[model samples]
Target: MSKTFLKKRYGLLVLALTASGVALATVSQPDLPVAAAYKTERVVQELPMPKLTINANASSYWRDEEVRTGDTLALVLQRLGVSATSIQNFTKSSPIDLKTLELRAGQIVSARVDSVGDVTDIQFFRDDDNGERNLAAIERINGKWQLNTSNIDMETMPSLRSVVITSSSSGALSRAGVPVEIRTSLKEMFSEKFNLDELVEGDSVSLLYESLYFRGQEVATGDVLAAEVRTQGKTYRAYYFEHGDTGGNYYDENGNSLTRGFDGQPIENFKRISSPYGIRRHPVLGSIRMHTGIDYAAPIGTHILAPSDGVVTFSGWKGGYGNTVMLTHDNGVETLYGHMHAYVRGVNVGTRVKAGDVIGLVGSTGRSTGPHLHYEVRINGQHVNPATVALPTPKLSAADLAALKKYQQKTDETMAAVRGLPVMVAQRD
Candidate 1:
């Protein structure tokens, strides 16, 4: 009975397992449509692409043009697309006195334009001989325009040289084939120490001046880097140095102050003067008067070098003094040059003239008897005879002293090398 019951139960269990397996297989498998039943359809659609078009007629809105020679304000405006009416109105209603078109060459003119090609604004910058810059601005206003002028303070360095032609005139430097530029610089450099008109021919000068090099070309003279001048067998050396604490100044090898306080005056660099410092019979005044400054009569216009760097306080006519230029130095010293024949055009009152700049030509313009520069030195408004004044030498810091020692060593070696080669004397003393 047990064997027959077991066989029937096993047969039923196998049939149930088979049915469950078939249901599980059907649930796990996915149903897909037949390739033939589904029609093969392809969709083709067009897209909108952006087409970029650039306007070829539009000109550049900004431009820079260097002011060339013979370029006037009108021409510059016209070149920048300023309309005729705008130009006329600018000329008419402009507050600036445009009668004198003072535009100069080598200046930079910047213009801003609008979409309609009208100049919005224009700026012109020009440099003057005093190393200061003048900026003129033209702006559009209510279909018209206005011009404004302003000044830009600039530090200028001018390198100049001149030769001594005669033993009696300051212009001797210029006459002896010394470039006018250098002659002017020499005057400025020694304005405080001596008068240019008193220089004589036989004087020798050597200078190292600063220049600005742009694109491997010297664009302008910057400053008097260093200089040495020998007048009448007297050697004078000057060097430019910037103080770590104070800033820019000129000094000699000894640590003493070379700057005058007033504006233009002489610093130390000379020995005993030919003329003593005291009240005596005036050469030109023809009366007994105080000889304010000691005279170093070499020749006329030998090459008045600057005693120190300073500014021209007054450079025109003074009461009795002919064609005089007064320089105010940095160390509260003021110097005066009288009897000048002519002056450098750019130098004027309030103009910053560095050391060794020529302020004027030698002439007996004022109460002078001969072509000589009446030189004077004043300290704090008091006249100090430059001949007797104990000028202070510039001091050097320890670090600077060390550096100077190294430089002197190198300079000595260079001088020795040059001396070893050159035995030919160019000029006889």
Candidate 2:
């Protein structure tokens, strides 16, 4: 080939575009957004266009190759026709070592190359241990390579699967290409409905969940959106809903929560009810007053257990209540414990506590006649009768039920589109 032809073959296609115009619109809303989520505006203006060429006769195009089971940046780029210099720049100039980058088997590494095999730009996502993806890129800009990074939200689609159990649940799910993560999620999602381990030989399961994708390959599985289980001629269906207060939880067809609820009362070493939650005669004030919380008659220094999983919001002295502790749980529920004799060591604001965890002790620190615990349950800042209170589930919300119906309709449509072909790709709304 002529020198002019050789020089032209190795020419680079400069990107007139800049990363500033790259709008990566992310829908911060959790699983299954409302009707307004029909529009997805992610990557409206990417830095490098899909395909480009220097001349009509040039054989150049963008190529996307998946990282194999045991592959490195050098091996994958060499197979993608990237030059030695560009490959070196990509490995050395990346924010993290490209070799040390944890690349999943099906991860997509994209590159655009010229006819002479010199890469113009290369891009891929590097995921942390927490499964969050950050875009890392190296592009030839102004005759020199430059790196860029930003938070990324991968493409999500509804993945449908139907399988019958003839042997074991894990074996059946694994044979159907369901990842172990998704399998574990399916078990937990349907634990309240039916035990996955107890599924009989003829039992069956139909599921709909999110499949995260990059470059047309599924990289990971997301939250379980909906599922159905059929066993012994009985069918149970569950749909996931995102409540305004509760982040995400599953519910049955009649809007019953499938999440495992809190164990019973807050205190374990209880003796008797000195005062119930309501209007009653105050022993210390010596007047009829509205008692906002239930006073459990327990010995001083008795252990106080958290009703459920919650974050400590307050753990200090209050005016009349003296030493107090407050916990904030999901679904707009908050609990307050007053007149504590002593607090559990390391119990403070922002500390997470699970059910049956010791948070404080019971004592009549405030204006009280004897040793007792004043426990209050509040829903949306309004005091309620703690004696007759039950934890509210996400399905009880009218707005959540309506949104769930809409999501169910959309899911049916998606499933109908692939009646026989179970595995298909359709962008989530």
Candidate 3:
């Protein structure tokens, strides 16, 4: 964009914020009004006290604790106020192998502790015998500890969160309960627009995302639906729009597309691009052959995520690329993931997945010598170098603009829910 356009964009404040709409928020406060017609009266009644049971928890409440780095089973239980005896019983009685429990930071563990500091029940998830993570819980049943490992039906819901910038963006997002996956998307969206580290103290951040709940507890978080960051006297926002069974893209309120490139990276935290697209030298074959995909070197079991929303057209083994998965997307675009250790459970043919959703694990499975992920992008079945994909600022048609406005209606509803609690409080006036 030209300097003149940038100046005009920044000059437009709030109501005229963008071509789509202004990012709005209000603190959640419900007002209770007193009834003027009712007269006040005081009454007291005497009642007999019932007998209390000894050595029983009179007040049991739920407490949540997050697993941290270098934390052990005992440490987590101790932090949750579980007594030593109860912790010992929990370990010995858990259906899943407590000794083999691998603690990953950021996982929430919920426990019910009594007034005396004895744990009555605790809920957590861990890798099962088959290497699949499943929800498991230990509860006191008839004075004996029992374990239950069952898959609870998941419920999908929308989540909105906001925070005033006061230190680092990551810390602020974490304190606001934004999921790590959603945080990544938010950062990527604004990475090209501004530097988050340079944001001033009063600048605010807000986000809308998809949340998954299992048995009333949030099990996982999905894609970021929308996000806004107010900094340097201006508000920049992006909204995610799903194009039916095809895929979704991020756009400014004005309906122009906004993304780092044509699409996002398939997996984050890869060591390096072990091999780039195009033919040079074949490592295993020792012959110059066409290298059709980009190889991302990462440790085995590292998650492979979908670059965008799409439906799985293929999920199985193929010639040299072992355990491959292929997805078909809009605009005749398709993506392929090869050399996988294993596919994420339930991500089979015809399964619809969103960007950031795990599809497989990284590994060296086919015609290779070490662990790496082979990612390929195909348009109309023709191979395109992933590294050369460029960002396009295409013009929107009249119908397209109308559809974009219709999509804004959804975000407008989300904005209203947070309208009273403005994140950019200092600049609201």
Candidate 4:
């Protein structure tokens, strides 16, 4: 802490450099003594060493509580062992606006209270949309409460997972020690082509992803860099590559977009494909009949979105179809949606809608047995199979394709290292 202490730390360095036959002509050290002038002395009296004082209650600490649904400030503070008086004092003296302090579910708040029912320290780490953490600390400084806000550094780490599926994709990933967010990202990445609900045993998948962490704890997942899946003797691979400065998108081995220009499914979250679009026995009529549309079972009020850009052709009730809505798209493509609890406001006949726009809610409005969505895709005037319909995929340019190939090769090397897969060895005689 003092000039003398700093000089003592660097004394050895200066002596070593000087003794190596290197003349230290520019070095200035007026206070340093020469070896001939140095002398040892015997102490006539010894000075008593000062005793060290330690706080007995310093180990008593704070607790953290995640803000949950229906949790108020007082409730969260009480859960963290902060007394009522402490909460009152914290609320009154804190500089942060109470209205701006909107406690969201999953946000963490930490607090420590003293023996006399007073708040000694409190901290809350709030993360924003831009992946930045705003740390707010309330502590007793100089015998008074002080509120301070600072920024903490964030880090991202890459992870890899390889799993052999014995049952479902989610189950296999869980057993492979994959993070929840990574599993969700992988599922969403291949939602258009892969039917996660229809996975069979013996299927396998490998994934590489990035996780955003703060203070050594993972808070969010960035993107799935590369993923490969094998099912039924067929392999499907998707690699995330950015084209120019636009943004990154998933592509297959042939440098084609993983998803079609438009999504195929009408409902994002469906309980199951209650019935596929084909000839099947009617559940209610007890007779083999032509099933014109696919049935997606969902809750009573789940959102139903437009598969692609189109104009609403019909938005009212149809016989046996319940509250049905039909949209006319380009290239003689038309889509029909039925069994809606209610149509989204402003969605009506002749109203133009974009792809992925919410059109209605899932319901059993007309002649139906339960809550579900009856989706039908028609080309020209004839009904077509929505599940097997061939959709259009975008292709990458020549330059972009070359870049992607290089990136893919590097990613493959990283994946092999992460999984510790065996490499081929060369032997010479």
- Give the alpha carbon lDDT tens digit for every residue of 328-392 in model 2: 88644688888889999999999999888999988878666688878876654445444323333
Error of model 2, residue 380, in angstroms: 35
Quote model 3's TM-score: 0.54
Model 4 per-residue lDDT tens digits across residues 1-429: 699877785786588787896755564445555567667888798889999896535554565566777777678888877778778877777766655565556555667766555667766644332112344556777556776433434456666777666777777666554555456546655767777557787777777776444444444444577888777788788887753322356788888777554554578664477766433333453322345567788998999988788899999878667788999886456788887899999998999998789999999987787998888765444444454232223468898899889888877776655342212111110
Candidate 4: regions farther than 4 A off: 1-148, 164-168, 171-181, 197-202, 262-394, 418-429
Number of clashing pairs per prediction, in order = 74, 0, 10, 0
| Model 4 error, position 389 (Å) | 19
Task: Compare candidates 3 and 4 on TM-score and give the better one.
Answer: 3
The CA root-mean-square deviation of candidate 4, after full C-alpha superposition on the true structure, stands at 19.5
TM-scores, all candidates, are 0.32, 0.43, 0.54, 0.42
> In candidate 3, what are the lDDT values of residues 1-429, reduced to their tens digit?
689855654465433546667564533333346667968899999999999779665598887777778888779989988889888877777656667787657666778889888887777655322112345556787777776433334556777777877787778767766655456557656666886667767788777776555556665554567777888888888877654322356788898776545444687664577766543423443322345567788999999988777899999887568889988765346788888899999999999988778999988777666888888765444454454332223446788778878877776676556542534211110
lDDT of candidate 1 vs native?
0.52
* Distance from true location, Cα of 26 in model 3, Å: 61
Angstrom error of the Cα, residue 15, model 4: value is 70
Task: Please report how far candidate 3 places residue 393 from its true position, in Å.
Answer: 11
Where is model 3 poorest over a 10-residue stretch in terms of lDDT? 420-429
User: Where does candidate 2 stray beyond 4 Å?
Assistant: 1-95, 99-133, 137-181, 194-205, 211-222, 231-233, 261-392, 398-403, 416-422, 425-429
TM-score of candidate 1 on Cα atoms, chains taken together: 0.32
RMSD of 3: 24.3
Q: Best to worst by TM-score, what's the order?
A: 3, 2, 4, 1
What tens-digit string does per-residue lDDT give for candidate 1 at 281-322?
334433223344545443455444456677888877775676
